[model samples]
Target: MARLDIKRKRVALTRELARLKHDLQARELDLEIQCRAMQDTLGELEESRSRYAELYDYAPVGYLTFDAKGCITEINLTGAAVLGMERTRLIGMPMSVFIDKGSCQLFFTHLRSCRLTGKKVTTEVKLAPKNAAPIHAQIISMPLPGGKGYGSQYRSIIADITERRHMEQEMLRMDRLNLIGEMAAGIAHEIRNPMTTVRGFLQTFMRRQEFAHIQSQLDLMLTELDRANAIITEYLSLARNKPVDQSLQSLNKIVADLLPLMESDALLHAKWVVAELPDSLPELRLDAQEIRQLLLNLVRNGLEAMAPGGRITLRTAVEDNQVVLFIQDQGPGIPAEVLPKLGTPFVTTKEDGTGLGLPICYSIAQRHHAQIEIETGNCGTTFIVKFPYPK
Candidate 1:
């Protein structure tokens, strides 16, 4: 009986040991699965962080962070490029350094407004980046809460609005052109008829024996009437009913043919004329007569503006798929007040000028589907006519 009892105890002990071993193995398998899941979560987090970094750096608009002192704390790639500087070098630099002198007050006011109200503020300003032309920028800034004993900060988004501003200016110019066209059509016929009748009477009087003594005075009067008639003709040219006869023509050849006439006029004014024509230029669809008139008017204007010994440069080139003609004069530049009013009817700087010359040129350019851009400063003035390439 004692042997049988010991056998039963041994069997029970073995069964308990087997159950404990199975429980330990199950716990180890669960831990391994949990470890794999943790690894996957870590991998996903890393990928998400990388994607966020790329989005922050490669955004289209410029993004910048400014400290309480208005110095740059953080800048993205686009922001650095807009300022024409390297990100590393721009760090800690004052934001005002990139702002144009004329727009400093505007930027400061915007920043102050944002900080004081703890709200978003926006402004348009000119930014003069290094090694780049001044650009019109629309800046939207929001106040950022500070942390770790720091003061309020600013986050700004900057967008380049130069093209938008140009479009606005162009629209205004077209409005002026339309108004001039309407005025020209209304009065051109009335003025030409009276001028022509007076010119005919003056000629008839000059041929008579009784008017022989005053023939010179009569001749002057006739000349004045002819001048008036010429002005009316130019004014009439602005009529849209007169269609342009366009043909594929070489601009270089046209310029070459006009060189002699331009030089003669320049010499009469005691100024030198230079033509810079490229050896090869693309042909353009244009009205040859109108283009000739445009060149004559622009060159004559340039020559007239200069003093003796001043030089006028007429150049033709291809730029950005367009044909360009530029007339530059070494004058004291256009007056500030007159600059904005250029190409308007009867807006002239010369005492004897009827102010119709530039307006006529503008009319011709518009008919040819071209644009005229003027640049003037203390040094001189340049008129650039850009014609689109034939489709």
Candidate 2:
């Protein structure tokens, strides 16, 4: 009986030990699985870091990082190249230094907004190249998060968009000029028959000298016909297919010559004409006829801007190797909305005006490689003509 009891106790002990061993082995397996999961997580983190680095280094657009104080901290190779500076040199330098001096004020205002508010900003600006010539840039900036205790920093993506912008402008200009040419050609052909009929009738009627009482009327009609012919001539001039006849022409001489003629029409309105120009200035390579006609159109527009007893000033100056001409009038300044599209054909602020004057002026300026700018306010409007030096 004692042996039987002892055997039963031994069997029970063996089963209990086997169960404990199984539980221990299961725990070991679980531990190994957890360890593998941890290894995978670490490997994934490393791969993500590599991918971010690759993107940062290989971005096509120039990337840059700057502190709130405008000092550059890090710049990609592309950024350095765009700025025409070494990465080491760019670092610690104020990013604003790269902005063209003429536009720095505007650029800084936009920049300050992004830095202080942690907002995103974009601008199209001109950057001064190594040779001091300007190159266009499309820049995007944003506030980036940084390490704890580190203040927010700015990151920029910049692209050299000079050629792209130039091409776009050229294409638009060509389209506009083409449309003007088609219109002018069509109108010239249409007016030719009427002009011939008027000329023949005037000649035949004038030979009847016995119609002395009607001579004055006949002369007036002849004058009107001549004016009509002049208008046609100008319309045809707009479609000039020949290259611009570039010659050094004095802008002051042109303006001076046109003053008497411009004020003649305005005499009925009793407006005062003002001329502010120096004795002489350098000449520009220009088409004398085109420029004179443009000036006439602009001055006539100025004259029509005012009521009786208003003032008009035509001013000229030499600025930085460019001919600066201003036609200002104390009349109803152009509306802000219309200022941008003032050069578009058939767009006019005046009820009776054809709106072709400015478009023609713009085309002639383009041929001369000149820029036309308009500044209008409650006080007055000024049309500024800036002619570039011939290349």
Candidate 3:
């Protein structure tokens, strides 16, 4: 009995030792899993911080962080450059100091409204340079929702919009073309009928044998007569005082149909053409042929403006219930001084060019109840044709 009692105690001790070892292993595994989770969370937080840092440090536009009292707290390099001061110098300064004198109240009102209602305000703001003329900017004020416990941070974004303002001025100049088309209506119609009568009489007289030597002269007269008729026809189209033959036509299809002709001309001039058109465009009521012709004139002018090996970009989009086509070109854009003469009849760059092209485009827009806007600069020129959707 003593021997049996010793064996049983030994077995019980062995089993207890194994149970303790298993418990220790399980505790170590739990600790390792928790440590791994913490590491992963720390990595994610670091990545998020890096992204925010990049956005704050290198933003392309002016970025300014301010308090409700209009005190600048932080600003990006772009913002500092715009304010004509160093980043450190601007941190504690009043933001109003940077505002153009005439626009201080406007900036103040926008800042107040954004902070109070958490809304955004954007518009043109002029800022005087330290040693130069004033610069125009498009300012956007946004309320940066405060941190979990902090509620006093708001920021504003500003971009140099001097180029855009210049574009608007260009569009205003092109608007004059609309008036020239209005003047050509009667002259176009009256001259067309007389041209046809003159052509018929000249053709009959030129076929006579008695006038052999003068036949060549008659031929020259006939050629000039034809040229005159063509001019009248073009003018009539320009004075598009007619109604639209509305039909459901796809814009993409229209572009496709004209592609071959458009490409041929562009290729002959050694121009690079890019068409950013979709497989389909929304069908709308339009006089398709007229619109095509309008596009042709604009594209042709673009091709002519540049020498060999130039670039043209064509794109279309839908905005504000209107079909807008953008035709752009890389060329020395229209000079601001001479841009105003674009659509006046007989005003042209080429020796034999008639300035009626743009005016005709304007008349086409009027007939379709559309609007055309032209924007040009050293980089390029873009013509936007806005076709409205009938409600």
Best-fitting candidate, measured by TM-score? 1
For candidate 3, give the lDDT of residue 68: 70
> Candidate 1 residues 1-391, lDDT tens each?
8999999998998898898889888989889999999999999999998898789888988999998888999999989999999999999999999999999999999988887788889999999998999999999999888773323789999989998998787667655666766777788878778877888888899889999999899989988888877776776665545678999999989989989988888888788989899999999998999999999988888777788999999899999989999999998899989886887778888899888788778878878889999999988999999999988
lDDT, residue 156, model 3 = 78
Tens digit of per-residue lDDT, candidate 3, span 1-391 = 9989999999999999899899889989999999999999999999999988778767889888888778899898888887788889888888777679998888778777776777787867788756556778877888877663232767778888877876676456445544444455657667767887888888888777777779878889988888877766676675445546878888777877887888888998889777888765678778898989888999999998987899788888888878888999988899887676665567788777877788778777777778888899997899998988765
Full ranking by TM-score: 1, 2, 3
Off by over 4 Å in 2: 1-174, 186-191, 198-231, 240-246
Candidate 2, RMSD to the unseen true structure: 16.7
Ranking 1 against 2 by lDDT, winner = 1
Question: For residues 310-390, could you state the per-residue lDDT of candidate 2 as single tens digits?
Answer: 888999998998879998988888887887567776788879776678878877877777888889998888999999866
Off by over 4 Å in 3: 1-190, 212-216
Structural similarity to truth (TM-score) of each candidate: 0.74, 0.54, 0.53
Location of the lowest summed lDDT over 10 successive residues in candidate 3? 173-182
Clash pairs detected, candidate 3: none
